[model samples]
Target: MEKLIKIISNRAVLIVLLILIQLGVLFAIVFRFQNYFVYFYTFYLLISSAVIIKIINSRSNPAYKIAWIIPIMLIPIFGTVIYLVFGRVRFSNKEKMKMAMVQERERMANESTVAKTTIDDGNPNAIIQSNYLSKHGEASLFEHTTSEYYPLGEEAFKAMIEDLEKAEKYIFMEYFIVHEGEMWDTILEIMVRKAKEGVDVRFIYDDFGCLFTLPHGYDKKLRDQGIKCCVFNQFIPVLSPIFNNRNHRKITVIDGKVAYTGGINLADEYINRIERFGHWKDNSIKVEGEAAWGFSLLFLSMWDFVNSTESNIEEFIPEYAPGELPENDGYYQPYVDSPFDRETVGMNVYLNLINRATEYVYFTTPYLVIDNLLMEALCNAAKGGVDVRIITPHIPDKWYVHAVTKSNYAQLIEAGVKIYEYTPGFIHSKTCVVDGLYATVGTVNLDYRSLFLHFECGVWMYKTNGVDAVLQDHMEIEKLSQQISLEQAKNVSFPKKVVRACLSVFAPLL
Candidate 1:
């Protein structure tokens, strides 16, 4: 009875029930007005045609277009309605205008403090990448920056707490998840103390992502503690296309001098305090020096978007006196991606790394659902004598996602790409290391939702300590992971194969 009540009161369950009720009402109205069926069919046909044209014209992945078209061809009336309601990317005009305003504000901020990007003439490939990000992603590279990699969430959490305690100017945290547990409780104590000390402590968390973990009035509670908090893109009771674009980036900036970003979130499970998935494995990186300014800008941009207030971005810019800066070692370029922007910075960065690799490419991600572009890129790199390797989860947090991930194994294995599953448990780390010289670490995942739909961010490193650390961690994790032989991939059982095939067709939608 207790389990039944829990299910009845669950937010996800309630949302599904509401959607079903709406669908039922629509069907009833259609049936009751049967005599006007001819007019309704004509309207449906016109809408379907218009939708088909729009999908073709829009600059979306070819696979996504086919996925939507298949169902539309099968059931025109319902499909057309669903496509307009969900498939259309340009759903919110207000959101588009707001994002434009935010970008303009950022541009003005950058103009105030013009930091010239210095290129390492020795590493031509790295120079190419930095230029690409600067041109398309609107991010500049920094030469005087250093980084430290944490192979586990606990390690990152320790470093994060240390940095939080040292914040004398401001502390900005933007994350997708924040559960009220041992991890957050400890952090909250620090943040509240910092806020009371006259430090500007602000936080941004996604509404739908934390719907189950946080209480409804949690933002108010945080504000009561003198911490400025806002929920990003608040979830509505009715269905809408805006929900597709989630704030998936995890970032924390302290005093505009140090920053952090990666798969780790503010929750106990992330640090393995309370194990839900067996031995939760993850990674994070701490960046110090000039590049930290980029992350600070990223956080402020989102904060402005949600609060409708333009901030003086220059106020937070780091002023590193002589000898206060970290050693000028390697190149560091921190960049952000958004669904609001037509460019796919995260995906392009991954693709560029894969294409430029001469020796090897290694990556670790929680989910492996990818499109043809990424699949082909990995396969081609492997086929061209590059050692392409990927590590996914053995004990999955989502069974359906695991099934879809497995569906693509055969093609990759056949192309000489090595696929491995972390044997101990789920690997939630989002990292990519190529040729031991280039790398990226952040919240971006190797899946359709992350690549093309969600708002994400990462740091592209060249010959930095971060690159070497990423390669070292990849090697260490590879030992604990079990490789999937090509024969094993080919020998999937018939029933499971059928289920996977069906799931793969809709994987993009998932």
Candidate 2:
């Protein structure tokens, strides 16, 4: 009976049924008024034309504009409806007002965050990148902040559990996916016990991301256990473009002393307890000092927005014994990318790292769907004597996306860039290491969804332990991966090549 209820009440089923019914009714209307068909068709065509024009004139991604234009011109009747429901990635004016207010309050409170920290001006590349994040991304740069990188998901999980158990004041966690398994059960038990012990515990999960993984009204269930929970952007059964933007960030902050972020979600597969597509490979990082404060504020801002309440920034500040933190390192900066901000913080960071590379740049991403600008920068860097390498999943979780990933391989290989597919299994880590001096790790992928339509975060380190660790990990992982050459990319069957070419046209929407 429970299984039957799930099948009947599935959100996907309901959405499809509703859409089909609406489409049927519209067809009936058009058939009944056949005499005015020309007028109706003309009106929709004009609307579609206007939308296409607006898209071309707007400052959005070129690929996104071209993708939308194809459908509008090919299927003029229903294209406008589809575009209205998914193409517009903007919030209403009222939401913009509220966001402005939130930014203002946070900005005033963060004026002192990086006032004392300085990036060495000797590296003009590092200086410009740090300033861009501070002024545009509203993130601070910190010096002497300790960082630890985990090459495996299970390693990060074990370290995170240890940190969570030590929470004395508060625990904040925000993730894109939270499945009920050994991994989540273990963390949930810790959170439940900590909440009962008076530790302020909070969890924020994206509703759309957990649509099938979690039970309905899961937030209320957590709230009943004394854990403050917020369902980020509740998913209702409808066709709306606002729902396209997702909270893809995975973050955890323990009393502002320790924080974790990466591509690892709260699921058994991430930890490799169970296999879905062979061995699951991923990475995560732990910041254990003043830099953790940055992730804490990042979570609080999203929490405040969802709950409509401003939290006291001072209340969650880190309090530690004199000798608690590890000795200082080099510069560390944590920043976020959001659709609301309309700035591609993650993409720009990757571009800056690639363009400024004097020695080499390495990347690991599950998806390799990127725009022309990033592709050009990487090719240029490789051509100009800078080594460029990217590692992607050999065993794909999504075949279509993997095809799109392969579609760009020949061009990259032609320009001297090297590509590798992880032979072990899926490499679900979003990370970049450059020149053994700069590194970043978090949830930002090279794909369009992560770059333009999701909320994401990462830590950028310069000349720190993290940089060395990340570079070493990349080099080690490369040994386990198989290099894809230009011959392999271009020797595909004709039908496969045609499919990939078609898929590439809509890669941005993937």
Candidate 3:
């Protein structure tokens, strides 16, 4: 009786009943409403048929194809309807081309500047330098930059504040998340002061990235303070379904010479002062030199897109030529990746490093939801006798996401890859060191979201001492992490495994 009542009370039943009643009324008025019914059914059938054809031809992953095939075969009409609205790629090709064109322009403008500084005075291994240029198309330029790797967020914050205080010409800051907290307050104060002093302060924050953290009209509030602000991809409540795409980049370029990038965000939690998760262990790198110009261009490109204004590239160029630092480091090539383009530059860079690893590959990411290509690359590396170790969070902030992360454990473990979970708190660092020769630090996570949905940036370094520092930090993190054995992973509860399996099916969508 309860089940019957529940079924009767369902909204679907009400909708169906309304449709039937409307049909009956239409039939009764057929003499007068003949054109209305004819046009309605005709348009419906035309849309349904078109949807079916699109579903039959749409591009998708193997898992998505198999999952969608069942529904497409079972219910042709409704399946086609759903696929047309949601199954197909959400972004338009025209928009993608526009993004690509913009990026190409920006790259072309910076290429000359990048090429002029290719001689590495620090003189890294010739082989490694050639490999980077060949594999990533990034010429290893002489980077006379002082890089300070902050192992914790507090140290990074202090450094960022100091750099912001020293801003003279312009301050271009971009981040994925900036919550209303002590960290943001401090930064906001600096931005306001800089704007007041006619310092040309500009900001670009991801809209979806800070959906709940920021209130409506926040951009206007910043503009009112004389600080130029642009929210990337304004969020709309009505378009809540398309929330997968986001700007997942954190960049700060001060005076087009000093820059900062890493996993750290402008939030108190990152500093460990407000412990929402655990210790909030994260890392950031501060760069000051010709390399900082690359980051400045990246920020200016996004700013141009948001503000719909042409960026004067020459205006941002430093008056004095970038001279080598007293203690110069090797080339630092900081590049960005956009989902708008088909090329997965950042992902390919990582895969190449993993494939070329002769000794060891160390990785730290908050999530480990990987696609087939990445999984096979890492597994093959491990099988070929490379020591592969990854550190993830033990206390996950998202239980479902954590389950999805662990679901791939069986395959990785069987392939000889070691896994560890940080016991103290969440490990939010997205970093990798391969053979102690190549190290990457940036906003790219080991997941589909970072790889295929969001805008991300990272610095690829070879022969820079920063690689050693990142490896040392990894070693220190290993002490705080607990290794997960194949035995333990295999014995996970059946119910939990079922949930993980279900979540894995939707990993791409997540």
Candidate 4:
């Protein structure tokens, strides 16, 4: 009874039930009016044609358009109605106004931190990529910054607590998941103490991501402890597609001088303290100096959005160095991506890295449901002998997603793109290292939702300790991962392969 009650009380279960009930009623109504079937059929055709046309014209992935088109063509009855409710990407008027405020504040913050970093004229590739992010993502490149890499979540947790312990002014954290466990408990203890000390401690977690992991009134508990807490896009029991827009970013900014980001979430499983998917593998970067300010601004942008309040963003900005600056630690540029933005910054960044790789490019992502453009880029890079490699999970968190991920492996392997699966367990790390010189570490996954629908963030680095650390971590992961050969991928059973292919069509939705 207790387990049943808990299952029914889950927000996801409730939302699913509500949507199913509404859909069932709609279907019943349509079936009841059988006498006007011809007219209904005509209306359905017209609506579906219009929706399909609109989807083709929208600024989205080709695979995504094809995915929707296939289903709409097959089930013309309910397809158009579904498309009308979920297909449109335009934000509601209220959401637009709020996002405008956040974007404008982000612009203000970006403007205040003009690019003071300079690169050698010989390193034109680095400068070009950095310029691209600066122009489109409103990010600044920093030169005099240092970075430390944690190849495992356990290492990052230790470093994070140390940083939190030393924070003098403020702390800001935004993450997709924040489950209650030994991990979050230890972090919360420090955060509560810091809040009582009058530090401006602020936290933001995605409501849907933590819906089952956290209690319904958990935000109030944090507030009672003097910590400012807000849930991003609080989950509502509705059938709107806007619920898909999740904040998938993981960020921590302390005193505006130290910051961290990567795949690790505030959950015990992430650190392998309480394993759910065997041994969990993840990575993170600890940055200091002016580069750290970039993450601070990123956090404040979302913070402003959640609180619906704007102040002098400059007041929260902290100088990485008050006196003399440290030695140059190469260039670092942090950027963000949102479904609201016209440009897909994360996708383009990956493309740029692949397109410009002179030697090799390696990446680690839990999911691999990519669009044609990224697939083409990887294949072309591999054909050009760029040594393209990718690491996906052996122990998947979602079976359907794993099936879809493996569906693309055959194509990639045939193109000479080497693929590996972490044999030990799941690897939730989202990282890419290119040419031993450039790398990125953050929450941007290789899937459609992370690339297109979600709000994500990542840090691009060139010739910095961050790049080396990420490269080293990837190499270590390679050692523990089992490589997938073209023959091995081709030997899958026909029935299983068919199911995987079918699942791939719905990859965007997954």
Candidate 5:
């Protein structure tokens, strides 16, 4: 009886049941009025036609448009309605106003006139990418910042726990997934203890991302322990495109003095306490010094946006004392990407690095599913004599996504780009290193979801120790991975090829 009750009360289960019920009623109404359906059929066609026109004319990706166009044209009954519900939502006037305010607050928080660092001493490639991000992506370049790169999630976890122990002012954590296991338990223990000691602790977890990992009332439970918790975009039974906009960021800030961000989540799978897909692999970068200020304001802005309350963000603005500033390790700029800005910051950053590579470019991503533009850039770089290499997972967490990832291999391999699959297990790290001088490590996958739909973040480095560390890690992983040749990549079965073709049609949605 208890198991049955738990299943019935599961939040994800209840939402699915409610949506199914609504669909049933709608279909029943249509069938019951079949004699008068001739009038409605024309109306539905008009709606679908209008939606197709809007999609074609909108600033959406061409492949994304084709994905929806085929379906709406074929099934005119419910296709238009579904498209409206799951389509990419443009920034509304209200959203624009709120986001503008948040951006302004972020600017004011980092308004210190710390002289910008010069990159002419090293490579000019860093200067071009850094200037692009500063001018358009709102990522400010900083010196006097020290950074360390961890090639594994567990190592970064240990570092984060140590930093958490030293928090005197506040702690901010935002993650996509927070499963209740040893990983989260260890972190929560520290967060709760700090809260008891008068440290302000704030946590934000995405509702959709943690739907199955955590209980629905997890936020309330945290609040009861004196830890402030806000669930990002609470999942409701109603279908709306707003639910698709997820906060897919992993960030931990300690008193605005230290921070960490990468692909690791607060889950056992991330740290490999227990693995779902062979040995789980990930990476992270630790930032100390004034650059941690970037992550601090990023958290506060989202806090204000969710609560609909304008906070006195100046209160949390970090000011680094001259003695407190670390040695000039190198240039560090941690930036975030949002759907509202009409800028795909993560994808563009990747493009810039690939385009500007002099010797080689390396990437470690779980998914290789990409649009034609990105695919073309990879091919162009490889065909231009740049040694381009990518490492994806051998043991996939999702079979369908792995299939899509493999579907991309043959095309890239044909263009002389090397593709390798991790032999031991899944590689969930999102990292890119170019010419041994520039690198970015964070939570942006190569799929459309991470590139265009989700809110993402990463740290761009130039002439930093972190860059060398990331390049070394990539080289080591390449040794442990299996390279796919043109023959192997093109050896798919006939039926499987058909399946891949169909899946590719909807790759934008995937």
Candidate 6:
């Protein structure tokens, strides 16, 4: 009965009702109001035609142009409407300019003498030299910063808590998901205490990411505790189509001296206390130095976006004197990517590292959704004899996404690319280690959402000694992962194959 009622109230039902109303009006006009009916019909036709043309012309991605063109030509109105709503690229120029201004200021600050003097001479191997970083206006090296890698969630949590406790000046945190669990409670306690002590503690969490995890008015609760809180893109129950755009970046900067970022969110699942899938394995990086200030600025920008609060940049700069580097060793450049920009900097950076890799390319991501450009680049690298290995999860999070992930296996596997799935639990780390010379760790997943729709940030390290630690962690994960063979992919069930094919159509949405 409920379903029947729902059917009667659908758009199709509304359209039928509209048609009946038009017929009634026409009859009335023919008998008593002929002039009004003709004008109405003419106006409706003109508006409908204009909408149809607008929709047809909006079908844009170059890859899908041909496929959508025929449909658009056939069902000019309906097809065009769908295309206009879902197709083409859209960005706000105003937001882009705002972001550009912030980034430019950051660049100028990075080039200052004070920024140079802050480099730690003791650590000379901390810099990465890459065309992608240089082209994007990122620093070629980061000085006065040190980094620590946490391979497991428990370790990362402990380290993060310690860092928070040691924070003297301020604390800035941005996370996608913050659940009501022991993990968050512990952090919240510390945050409240820190705020009470007059520490400028601020936090930004994505509304959609925590919609189900947190209850209503959670942000208010945090603010009442003295912790400045901002919920990114507050989720509205209705008329909120943009909920898909999330602040997927996980960053925490303390006193502009230390920072943490990686795949781990503030949830029990990440720490293995309340496992949802299986043993959850993740990774995080803790950094201390001038580079950490960059992350602080990144968090501040997002915080201001949500809270409308302006921050003094000078206050956040670490106190250090300017001088020549004691050694030409450690330089660190950190940058972030936003969907508001036309450039897919994170994706392009990954591609650049893969292409320029001389020895090996090791990557870990939960999803394997690839666009054509990335697929070709990886395959070409494999064909060029660069060892390419990727680690994905064995315990599927979203089955359909996993199926889509498997569907692309054959092409890569045949090209001599090695793929593995962690057998014990889900591997949520989004990291890449190339040629043992450069590494990246952050929240940018290897999928359409992270590649194009969401805001992301990652630490790109080149010639950094930290690459060895990342490589070691990757090796440890490989030991626990099972490698997939072409034979296994070929034997996938027919029905499952069809499901994958259908899901692939909406891969962009995923």
Task: List the lowest-lDDT window of 10 residues for candidate 1.
Answer: 111-120
Query: Could you tell me how far off, in angstroms, the CA of residue 208 lies in candidate 1 after the best superposition?
Result: 0.9
Root-mean-square deviation of every model: 1.8, 1.6, 7.2, 1.6, 1.6, 7.0
- How would you encode candidate 1's per-residue C-alpha lDDT over 33-75 as one tens digit per residue? 6679888788777878888998888899887888788788897
lDDT of prediction 2: 0.88
Give the 10-residue window scoring lowest on summed lDDT in candidate 4: 317-326
Q: Scored by Cα lDDT, where does model 4 land?
A: 0.87
lDDT of 5: 0.88
What tens-digit string does per-residue lDDT give for candidate 6 at 63-123? 3344444445565344443444344445466656666666665566556523343334343
lDDT of each: 0.88, 0.88, 0.78, 0.87, 0.88, 0.76
Off by over 4 Å in 6: 1-94, 112-131, 134-140, 320-329
lDDT of 4 by residue, 336-443 (tens): 988887789999999999999989999999999898899999999999999999999999999999999999999999899999999999999999899889999989
- Across 23-99, the per-residue lDDT of candidate 5 in tens digits comes to 67876776676667788887777877788989999887788899889888877566776787677566678978988
Better of 5 and 6 by lDDT: 5
Model 3: residues with Cα > 4 Å off, grouped in runs: 1-83, 92-94, 117-142, 240-242, 321-327
lDDT of 3 at 158: 94
lDDT pick, better of 2 and 3: 2
lDDT of 4 at 392: 99
* Residue pairs in candidate 4 whose N, alpha carbon or C atoms collide under 3 angstroms: none
Candidate 2 per-residue lDDT, tens place, 304-377, comes to 88887888888887876888866779888889887887788989999889989999999999999999998999
TM-score of each: 0.96, 0.97, 0.85, 0.96, 0.97, 0.83
Give the distance in Å from residue 482's predicted Cα in candidate 6 to where it truly belongs.
0.8
- Candidate 3 whole-model C-alpha lDDT, 0 to 1: 0.78
Instruction: Return model 1's CA RMSD, one decimal.
Output: 1.8
